[model samples]
Target: MKVITTSTQTWQAKLAGLLLLCTPLINACTDPSDIGLKLDPEANRIGVFYAEIPLSAYLVATDSLNTTNAGVLVAGGDISDYFGETEATAYSRMAFSTSATKPENEAILDSAKFSLEIGSLTAEDLDETKTFAAHKLTEPILDTAYYNFDQLGFEETPFASGSFMLEENSDTVVFMNIDEALATDLFTKIKDEDPVFDDIFSFRDYFPGFALKGSPSQQTTLHVNPGTNTGFKLYYRNSEEDTISSVYTIYTSSSRHFNGVTNNPTGTPTEIVTEKNKAYDVGALVGSKALLGHLVKLDMEPLSNFLDTLDNVIFNRATLSMGPTENFPDSKMPIQGLIQYFTDDSNKILRREEDNAPYSVQLGTVLQTMTDEDGNVVPAVTSGGTNPLVFNTSEYIYGPANTREGITSYVDALYRTDVMRTDLLLYPAVVSTSGTSIITSSSITRSLREYVVNQNSITLKIYYSKLR
Candidate 1:
């Protein structure tokens, strides 16, 4: 997004004054950067999420187990008879959910029950029967799914948009394309005001009922109460100066969070909610819908811890799954290494069930690298996918499916851990700048907007020394 650059006079006096002020403050203060506005939160808030990305990669499936027990039950089932049985050859299709959809969306993707080598894939080296535990997902896929969409004769849309009943009588669909332009423009405007970034808060929100692209962005949805004019259209890299009037009012619905403000004149938007959308009479008041809606603008206390854990979680999975495309050269069954996490603890890191699982987060240490009969390292390959939420079981049944090799394969694709992680990761921290002194400021919507150039090139620099 381009900056709304405007020239200002008295530039000579301001630059000299700033250097002088900096000299004294820099010497006096231990950390001169610490001097800035203090932000206040609006209220007690928490974040609910559905998806996120990892800072690095991690391992998922392994060949060896580190349990003290000769054999422990695991989700993949027992391997007690691994060595007893013959080293059979079986194959399963290689695939990864580059995208995901809401559980509510119908299964259109030809998600095949990848034929498994049940007999050949034995954990016989294991002395005891082990089972991979069931758990919830913390960060599931929140994007589009080509596999399903292509089958359903639907094309993937580049944007996320939706509409709700304004109230009882108003039946208008709010179609929006909250593209990069919106974030860029908004951040630029914000930076134009508060460059020091004394108080810059970030949060994430979701619109469970609205999102269409796969699982969608965890913090993309938001509930905007249009004090009076209940309508807004957000286009990236744009600035609107009151087309007709300087004011506009947009009302919010119940739980549905909106990704952006877009009004489309297409499909006949039927009334879903019975309530009227005119009750939004107040200005700047946090509506109850904020909580009900999945859009979580996560804050400090919750999101920080969540992000710390989530980053680690996704990184592990990404490393294993996102490898080269050609994982196993010259093999009929080309399976992409979509990493899967299995913890035994009752209270799993993300979410878990009652199991004598260990209290260790050292998943990497315990599970050994997968190898073939010739002791060949099975290369884990993928397209660098985050934890994509499996929205359904019918398409690709995970639990107890018979393999071509005459053995029962049990699996329960879970979004519990991914879900829990998503909710916690996207709680946006509310950041506001307040002070008597003036500095160049820009919006934090887009990270790039935070940098101000041609002047000091300092981060979040406010162009104006004082409010005119």
Candidate 2:
């Protein structure tokens, strides 16, 4: 994804003025020559320090997610170590706008089938077989918005039921034959030119929609693209002597369709993270045992005290480092993560924008490496190993004190607040391009982590000049 680099000029000017006020104190330090001190221009002028503080985190559940315009429709069931079991069912109201004349009175309806095109699949879904049951919806799927938790009423008896076996490395379409009696009814109505078949509105009154649900025994989930290549097709013949057969199709549209997902955290890691009252255990082990999101709070009071102990200081760079525990393995670790700050109980900080263009700092993944006793370099995962998590905190710390009038906008005021503690959320890095202010389901996932503790809990490495 392309990064946006636009910012607010007014915010930058305010930050720059604050930095100017701190310059005089830095220049007031005593000269080295007056003290008869012979100091090398580039030798040991910068001081470095490291500190680790305790962390706290918790999992938050967001059930009422609007999935009406989501790109892909998801269906099936899966059990996650971190989130317990989740089952998803998709409902679509299909329609057809026709101008062709009705078929002959003697036309015979042969068959009707419902088909869905499979999109992408996860590694866990390889060679999977999922059983699905299609039920007739009791209520109309209105053109209005719907959420993931919305429960639409449907008939108790399924009109069609079948199982689809997923092939390895193949994107195959699944088809299920509809009840023959239902097909005959639709054929007769269309052939007889019934008033119900005249328009889409009347057509829906006779046939509301179908609700496709995954069987409870499913082990893996599947992505079903109902908007594009999904629909119901009916085959018929005008006469027995005629050679070719005719078909009528009805397609599912995105306007009145919804995907319902239910997350059951009964015995998963999410249960532990949500039920526990104390600080959370975040790292690879905790992540593997159960997928969980983290709420990391930075203890900034100690950092402020450390800065007060020094005189005439000019900060150069600050790096925050954290990694998996010594026993946590790298194979099970999540490849990417997202970090953001909370604004209130329900809101979160967002990228700064100017004239609709967004500007924000991008976070990258860092791996920790160390030399073993045998002198071979490898990932630091043993006792006395360093954590792999490292983030540059310079912009969040010193940037506010040296902001440029126009050049420094979003980055400068990132951490201008004087709060002693700041809470940051950590989750699997799911990408979004919609530019919405609130965090949606598209940006949340069930990833796990367990950071190093005690002496190696979480550390800040700061390098600064004494301004002698």
Candidate 3:
């Protein structure tokens, strides 16, 4: 995408004078920069310039995300015409609770079961039922992290299985009966104080973990929380004459669990962005899709080139305003907002030059009301206007314009250097700031792919102090 150069000069000076006057007032009667002191806009016959530059957006596959110890664990299948078929398998290591005690001697094993604490659900249709199976993992979950695309080996036969209709508020737990024989063996080992039960690490070698796999169903995925209360259980009678029963439970380790996702993009819009073609333009096809390992990459080469034409320029405010496509489906809630980060060539987020941490921002969300042709006021979404996703880019263009010298070590590298370029990746996420600040993982898609970038409404609006 390129800036409409035809109107560049005409639009540059439209708000030049007005912004110069307002800048001083906007800064709360403080000088924004020394550049304003040196080159007065009115005295030098210069003003603040503005230009709208178009940007190229691609719905590209995101780099594999680290799913280790992810706050939310998802399982089952999520099928969509827009995203294709996405399946998730959860792997978790089971450990004996610190207070876990052995069952009584001569205890008769009754039964065993595995259960999942369902946190939430993302489904195309709730009427459809999904069958989930719990298979013993062949290997232990590593202390190291696991990626969303990572798959661990598990037993072919499932020891337990259950079927149920997925719901967000209705169901709390999904339970499956475990094999009696296997349950009895586990009961005996605990009663006999087997060496494997000596420690959590030792026990993990004998019994690795459980891999919860779901049968393909409608687009429905369960966010399961296999915390301390959810896992394997053994029920047994203490003795022949004892009416009372004893229970021993193995809890899942929170720090040692992760979800593996498999996305088959066959016969879907995402198919175009396969391994060979990582980035595909969202020209007409409902804009760009997110999650299912997908992201939107914005290239601002045209805007960078346009910025080169001006000299002695101090950019006051550079805002990139954009929003979701107007034709977004009504079935799914629109993504609240997007998180932006600079990306490397591999689409991995780059670390900031100052702190070595990735620079990210929750773009400002704005609802701009406008009058239609018939003189009726309506929300932008109603009139197909751009719902504001305004991102401040002044610091990225140069240094902080409000600073004393307006010079910083972290500035100027991004836009000027090809090595560290100006490409940005946008992910569907919501940042919460209640007590503790929390950012939702971009890997968890909610199974709703309606939040696509509005290509037509995207504009890089630059506000610059045009000093000659």
Candidate 4:
């Protein structure tokens, strides 16, 4: 992915002249102690590499996202010249998967709807239609959780509405059209067995679910999937049958639903990522954004001060490279790759005392190749074409396992200056394997201002071992 038009302040002025030539040979070492106890029984190796060290990229955000039952529900609004208008609504509760049986005569209502089921769309939203609606939830999707900036209050009309349009691979759905006095008051309380169908907390105090929005002038973003043929239907017909089938339905409560979100960054570039673990400065102001969560903090302290000016070093191999922005296009909206994590200084996500879990990886996409000035070979596209996220980071700067006890070998926790220092964070993922199991997540539905992070193609490289 050749997009390295190079210049993130030219690798911060070449890692500030390699941290001023290794801080005066690390403060003129007179040896206050342990330089691995001054090695040299015959030590004289050498092998250096550092794609201009000091990497820094940011645009951090993400303050919330539990979104209860978040198996994708999201709604509409999608625009982004760099994450500006986002929107999303969905909330749920419905129920009645059992109990309540009365039909036989007197049921008359024949027609109501609601549906949902789409599951994805917004690979740059071509927009053939969109509208949607469905209101009626005057608060109550709570039996326990929901987050993503939660919110409530509804019923500003829209007992169902539509506009829809999808059809391509098929299985779309959407629907809407309800409101005939709220579908005849739930068809006169199931043809008169009322008492709110006596269960599930009196049918959630007599109905309290359905928000589902969409319609920010149809830029587009759907997702949806309340599955099992999403619900609400109603079509009865018994008043001595003269036609008109007999459905009922309600669904959508596999544990109350969620997805609230709102994001409005007032005109793009995520309005300088404004706080929440702050760190901005990735080029024209900032970049990394994905579903308002943003993220891209990488500070490997100038490659740990250039491996503290070598003194019998060892770390063999570490890659890193980067990609995405050149005019980013090509998308089934999965962002393609990047997940890295170790973070600290309040960016949290640290864990790993052997399975406390969090020292992650997975930067993905390889297959680069390149030669062509007749040397031939090719395929290395970047931006719209793709292929360039390489992050194998040699088990965090390989330090010969440093006697492994509770595992503190990220190069001895970056040369432990009494602790607190371990950066690397990147995030904008989506890996998915599952037949042999691989799964990685966090692609933040619809980020796409060319997705981001081409900070001059980042780099890193390392292969250390110098002692001369």
Candidate 5:
């Protein structure tokens, strides 16, 4: 694939001027009522074409996801009868103030409690009962590194266990009493060592951490606020006659913690297995199992060939459309999808922050619904209908070669086949905010069929003004 650059700066400047002239004419005459102004299509020299190309796609596992400063701690179990099962567990290293002094020998250890502030619950989970257990971590929670698939060692004995029905709770906070024996052991250690209670480093050495695991059940997962309303509190008395007892809280900070999520495709007919080959046609069956990470890789050779024949062309729009073979139920369909550059080195999805140019595009709300003649609403899958996923590649395709210098540089890179390659990756959308790390939900499962493009398929509509 190559782009030819033969025009000079003066010719490129004239083309830019022509583009401004065409913009107002196109926008003003778009409405039927305001179509009095006559516009010459031949003089404008605008053209449109349905770009035909081959696409290679497949599914890949996303393991060892980074979960630093994710704000919410995830824990729950969800099973998809058609796909597979998913379970999530949260681990955190609690921190206490280093400046705080240890309790005196006269202080009598009372009770201990652990609480978590629930953020959200899925609609399906509200009716069912779920049980959760806390275990004593055997190793320290490293502040520097951790992953979503990490399996940290923990004691077999549970610190506390509790069950709650989602419907019965209106409050956002969930509380559980820690075992008295565990509290007594901690009290004894604190009194004997008289250790500094302030720093996280020393605190973790004495008390490694805790792992909150949910019982395996096909229910909704939970998102709990780790920054606030999550901690371990130990209550004690200075003396037998003391009126007010002293309380110390170890907060579950964002320092060192991760949510471990495992997706098990045991019972599903289309079991998620490792793909030995990367370049393979994504069939209808494979595309329907998108939750298993089935992806479609678009080859950019067709687009590059189209650009090579044009000179002093200003691209208005270039879009790629993809759709499922059959209309899927709303519950089974994924609301969003992601398009990114695939690399073989790592399985984790790269964020916009990591790239120089925006290499990822989020296709929001793919399914379009319409009411039938009988007043029943359903997914749109008719001829000449909108695609489930559409990507506007105008900026990515044209923006690089907009200027004369950019065109020359782009053409040189294209010929080398080093800088200008048209292979793109499609996957399930994962969110990454300004200050927080990327977050992938374990509860949602998106499944759809492969999109096939032909001459009648939704074409790449490009509006441009060719320099005379």
Candidate 6:
């Protein structure tokens, strides 16, 4: 009872497969040993011939089959070669007997043994590789956890718990469901001396080409009896049914706010802040390098590259024109820095009593309501939910040191004629209701706005005399 090995034929099939797949380089560079294709040098493995058909079938005993003992076939006896072409079932295309299941059972007749022999297998010859009754199928197949006899081998083709008769020398086995998770584990077990040869046990019937000592006829005959589960290969072709494709670029993020926003919507009552939401769409200038510590800007690319960094630079109501004095938002104190700048720029070249200084303006906005798609009245955060523009704090950009703000100084410097010539814009479309439609609304709004400004940013400028 000599044990035979299929290492030789297996290598030939692999070579042919490699050439067919156009991966000749892999075949040439790889070694059967390095590739993990090996076996007990003297041991023999059973070999069986088979054909693949769509349906399942069993191997039956046969006699009176045509052979050197021919004429016995023409003689036609009651006895028929059950496994032959005549009595053969058309749909049934396989024959797996006891001898094929175990190495020891395969006598000189069923057993095949050969020595190392190198050979060639072109893509065209790949089809010539002998196939045996074996398979690896997908799991939970057709609901019953079926398996396909078409299954082949790679590193490990485990047999399910009760898939076969406990035969002697049964090195191959199948698991209920073998996925990539188990590929490595399975490969390690069945690879004789070379774990790399594990591919030979892969159910996909795929193998990397490696050196072989013999011709293509020396194939390892593996017997695979599908479990109660049906015949289906689960993700047979690829190590993974799903692929990992990831893309990575750059990213950035930041938080910003315009200092003016803290004041809130112009008309909003201090108590009303809790009642609404606000948004800003208009471009802002505060975030600019001006106002130094009063504003902060950042490089947004760090957050998300795709996201627009353009608008990421922003102004914080907290940091707006505010100085330690505190009127601006995002600030703990008032707009002292601004006051300093105003004082600096307003300082006369020689403090000439008549020196006229340059002038600039700060813009702020008021909050308003908008009807969203849902027809819900939404608080518009525009400019701290205030008006669309700033107070034009610039009027104070260059004013007398004693002025509440350049604006007030501007007022002081103005004469009756100058005041008349200077154009002032009321946030309301109409100065007072009298100028436009609902005169009533205008009057009320103008009165309230004047009062609020006078109370807040206005008062700070007047009393501080710090040119805030």
Output the number of the TM-score-best candidate.
3
Q: Best candidate, lDDT-wise?
A: 3
TM-score against truth, every candidate: 0.15, 0.60, 0.67, 0.36, 0.58, 0.14
Task: Give the alpha carbon lDDT tens digit for every residue of 1-468 in model 6.
Answer: 011112224555544332333222222111212221134533212211111111111111111111111100010001111101111000011111111122111111111111111111111122233221212223211112111111111123322211222222333333233234333332333222233323223322232111111111321112122121212122211123325322111000110001100112233222122311111111221111110111111111111211111121111111111111212222111111221111111121111122343222221222223355667543232221111112234342211222222232222222111211111111211111122121111111010111011111211111100010
User: Residue-wise lDDT of candidate 5 within 1-468, one digit each (tens)?
Assistant: 111111123545436544433223222122222221233444323332112222234444444345655556767655655446766777777776655566778789777878777765432544555677788899877756565557688988778776776642244777778888877876766666645354567777877888877754645555677754687777888789987878866678664676666667676633645452244432333332232233444444544555565555444333444433233322222324343443432333333232332333222222223344667542333222111232223211111111222123222233333332444444444333233222323222311212222212322333333445
- TM-score of decoy 5: 0.58
Per-prediction count of colliding residue pairs? 100, 12, 1, 0, 4, 99
Cα error, candidate 4, residue 42 (Å): 1.6
* Model 3 C-alpha lDDT per residue in residues 231-339, reported as the tens digit of each score: 8878788888878777788877554788787877798766777662266764644343333567777776665566455556665556565653453222234444455
For 46-95, candidate 1 gives per-residue lDDT tens digits of 11112121122111111111111101111121111101111110000111
Return the number of clashes found in candidate 6: 99
lDDT per prediction?
Answer: 0.19, 0.47, 0.58, 0.56, 0.48, 0.19
Cα error, residue 340 of model 6, in Å, equals 15
lDDT of 4 by residue, 169-282 (tens): 345777787878877887777677677876667877777877778864566656777755677878666775466577777767464787776877686656756777767763
| Model 5 CA lDDT for position 386 | 15
- Ten contiguous residues minimizing lDDT sum, candidate 4: 397-406
Which is the winner by TM-score between candidate 1 and candidate 3? 3
lDDT of 2 by residue, 97-213 (tens): 577545699987777887777764332444555677788899998878877667688999887777766653357788888887787788788888889888888988988987777
**Candidate that beats the other on lDDT, 4 or 6, i.e. the better one:** 4
Model 6, which residues run further than 4 Å from truth? 1-249, 253-269, 274-409, 418-468
Give me the overall lDDT of model 4: 0.56
